[model samples]
Target: MEITIWDEYYELLPRKELEKIQLNRLKRTLIRAYHNLPYYRHKLEAEGIDIHRFKTMQDLKHLPFTCKEDLRRAYPFGAIAEPLRNIVRIHSSSGSTGSATVVGYTAGDIEIWAELMARTLTGSGASEEDIVQVAFGYGLFTGGLGAHYGAERIGATVVPMSTGNTARQVQILQDFNISVLCCTPSYALYLAEVAQEQKVDWSKTRFRIGIFGAEPWSEEMRADLEQKLPIQAFDIYGLSEIIGPGVGFECQARAGLHVSEDHFIPEIINPDTGEVLPPGETGELVITTITKEGTPVIRYRTGDVSSLIPEPCACGRTLTRIKRIKARTDDMLIIRGVNVYPSQIESALLSFKELEPHYQIVITKENFMDRVDIKVEVAPEFFSDEVKTLEKLKQSIEEKLRAELNIHCHLRLMEPKSIERTSGKSNRVVDLRKKEGLT
Candidate 1:
């Protein structure tokens, strides 16, 4: 239960002092964005935002809000604040949802990112002595390099095992004696399954801590991981648009992910009205990059739903903590007038001992009504159960789903390993309404 904090001076700064730093950085970011980036300038002018008159943090409400669409519109380089000559590195989104959001970083920005990630690793109980293995993908995706730099910054022995090759990942876990692992939560579960298949002894492995993010997971998922693997799983939160994976991290307290307030300012706003909600109120997450020089966003709407915890953490960091992100506004599924989130389904499925964590939510429109069909993989032991037993289990699962989601769903029990697995973010939801010309 050792509490390790990187850059204690900044991480444990008093609330009043942190606000002063945030205000100063906010002003600098606004001035640079308004002057260098035409996109911000136009938005600021249209909203009649006066950067100089911003006396308190409350004035941030007057600034224009940025969204993914805006970043997509900016594309390649429209959002970058610094000159091309000064930009040192670039990372981008997968463009799987839309046009990719490209984020640039200056040498200073990279240093800041490394520092924030160092704090993240330290907060997650990773120390310089730990041999860290980063399983997130490299290149355009930010997770791999963001973690690589952070582990290096903290003086840890880093093994850059960038995604895929499940067998090799397990081999390295034992061969390299990796003490810390970083990857998506689903992928971690997949690795554990693979390890079991290989008959690898978890007790012999040095793996102790796992830092997972880049997709939404639930507490039930965390419990499953801890039960399956020999590690204490911690959640980390960040997006490529907001300095990759260093925006926030979980401390030893495991209460909530602490926002790196000195570097980025976070707010919760009503997704529909764009009105900022008070702390402890659930809403869309909005972030403003105060220290980012290459692409400083002004109240950028993250599309993530979470609330802020203003109370100080037992870890002793003054940074505000955000409830683990379980759903995004855009990811919420409206099925037959009921709102359903994939995580909700995952939670329900994991609650059943007969069900594996791997599942998919297939949404389609049937006769002008939305239908949710969940394909869940049964645990290996239950896969061979009698048809009657399987049917009874399926019925029980459907009843649980009905109770939890308040919506009827067709649950299909599949043999173990039937559902496809990925080394990166697992695709949990398949929405075919638009493809079926029903949207």
Candidate 2:
């Protein structure tokens, strides 16, 4: 029941004061984009938006929504508002397409990023006395460096164990007696398996806190990780386009992620119609970087599916909270004329105690129609020797899928440790329909 509030001045600011601060910073951000970035200027002009007339936060809706395509159109530095000389670092998405979405950070921007990350880590019960092991990948991917800098900022001893090297990662965790772990949830679970294989008892170690993000995960997975590792697992959220991995994070309260409203403004909108939905309504989460200097975005569509909770957090933070991301708009899968998300499938699978959290959803084209299949591994104790028992388990899984997904899907029961595991974000969906040009 311990609660730690980092940056009490900002984190505990009154709602009215926080909004006023957001408004002021937002004005400066808009002016910077309108005056420096031609893309924003042109878009504003085309929409007949008078930047000067933008007085209230409500006026932000009048501005056009910035999407990933717009970032792609702008390419490397086109969206940047600062001079190239002021830019200190650059990061781009690992998009498997043509142009990558590039983001720039000035020296000040980097400092702010580190500070926000510090808040994220500290809020998750990390402290200066703790040893943090960052397993996120470095380079163009922002997770590694973002968490790295934040750990450093908090004056914690950070083990810069990037990604991969599962054996080595387990060795560090054991030898260093790491107290804090920051990485994707899937990787955390994978590490749990690796640690077990290496005869490393996480409960005996100093491990106490886990900051997991960079991919969407379920509360079921969180419970699994916490129980498996005997640690408190928290969701830390951020995107490269929005100052990396410190845009917001879940406090010890664990109700929702408290956004750094002083820096970024969050809104939930209907993904299909672009209409701003009321608070508590599930929709696509949109954000505006109100304090970014290098590449400030206006109403940038995050494509992350979440809802805004207008009520104050029990942790006493006035910052707005957004429910954990359910699914991304781009991550949705259409199977048999039904829109499905991998989270839905994960939720259904996790409900079964006999099934392991490791599962995959596949959508392929069959005879001019879409076919849905789910492959889930059985827990070690739940594995059966009898064919009848296996078939019964499969039938039970299929029945659950049918009840949850409302459509028939092929169920492939896998043996323990049969499914491929990734050191980074887990690829849960395989849509062969897109490959067949049938989407």
Candidate 3:
């Protein structure tokens, strides 16, 4: 129950103790799941797996990998291990993919999550002496509650400032003298932009650190966030299935995220073959939470693409660090920052009657920027006019995308059949940013 907060805390422990302790946790989790979770028991039986055989981390490779579909197939409550009475809280996933994924937690599960977050805050120099402000949304969304509990556990003064109303958020920053901020990277940047217009003295504010996550952002974007905001920024990573943001966090040294391996075992593997990859090799991340009580999953394929490093970091933590996500493997274009999937775009575009579902997304390079071309094959009636329908369609798409993604995107229209068809997963974005950068 009293796990140390950082990898460095246990790095010096003899190799035998580390393995012995981890095995004990693993065995207990397996024994508990086999008895309480029918899905897990059935899965183990179907796969003919004996947890006793998986005595070491190396044995993880032999277990069947889990995926999001596994959750969908066991929807609502099948995956939950603990009974309804013990589950104290639940949160909905942002779900860019489809219907939101729901994550549940028992009181003990919440306690452990708070412990990791408290450890993370301490690593970043937050303490009872600091005031923590949370700007993420509350209710079903996980980010707000996650930060609130972490801040509370750390004994910091907590300000639960859920999203929307920029002026109010700014007022809290000035009045409360918030020393730490926990919110999405975009929202932090947005707040800074408002402060600039309002002539807010950002430097005078007490904020010393910002923990941003819940959305993918670029290093360039991260730099922008730090420069504009009043504090140094650290990346926080989590998912609904893994008990939210405390799963891994960045320290001031900023090498990579320190994974909470005591609770969730992190691994990287080839997206296609599920072959376990070595540290520093970029691949999809899969996590199996050993500590969750209400709904526990083993070898859950997170669908997030990242790499891992096992070496002790300069920050003196021996915990594993996961690289920034390259992209989500299952849902969409897993490029750098953009998470847009063509199917979701199609659904949006088709909502307008004038636009045809038959459109092509041509991702290309131009002038050191990503040139994305959305070619919507116009209906025969609209094509009859000599006036270029492309321009109007471009405007419509630009407006819709701006409203949806909060970023400006260029649009293009092609006659039907312009997009090259393929038998497998089709290319949605042809990134020319790489070539542009090279030249």
Worst 10 residues of 1 by lDDT: 380-389
As a TM-score, model 2 comes out at: 0.98
Candidate 2 total steric clashes? 0
Flag regions of model 3 displaced more than 4 Å.
Answer: 1-16, 331-371, 374-439
Model 2 is weakest, by summed lDDT over 10 consecutive residues, at: 92-101
C-alpha TM-score for every candidate: 0.99, 0.98, 0.75
Candidate 1, 1-439: lDDT as tens digits: 7899998899989999999999999998888988988988898888787787889898998788998988899999999998999999999999988889999999999999999899999998888899999999999999999999999999999999999999999999999999999999989999999999999998898899999999999999999999999999999999999999999899999999999999999999999899989999999999999999998898999989999998889999999999999999999999888888888988899999889999999998889899999999989875644778888889999999999999999999887899999988888899999888833
Off by over 4 Å in 1: none
lDDT of 3: 0.73
Q: How far does residue 112 in candidate 3 sit from its true spot (Å)?
A: 0.4
Winner on lDDT between 1 and 2 is 1
Q: Between candidates 1 and 2, which one is better according to TM-score?
A: 1
Q: Give Cα-based local distance difference scores for all models.
A: 0.92, 0.89, 0.73
Indicate which candidate wins on lDDT: 1
lDDT of model 3, residue 419: 53
Best by TM-score: 1
When summed lDDT is taken over every stretch of 10 residues in candidate 3, the lowest stretch is 420-429
TM-score, structure 3 vs. true: 0.75
Error of 1 at 46 (Å): 1.1
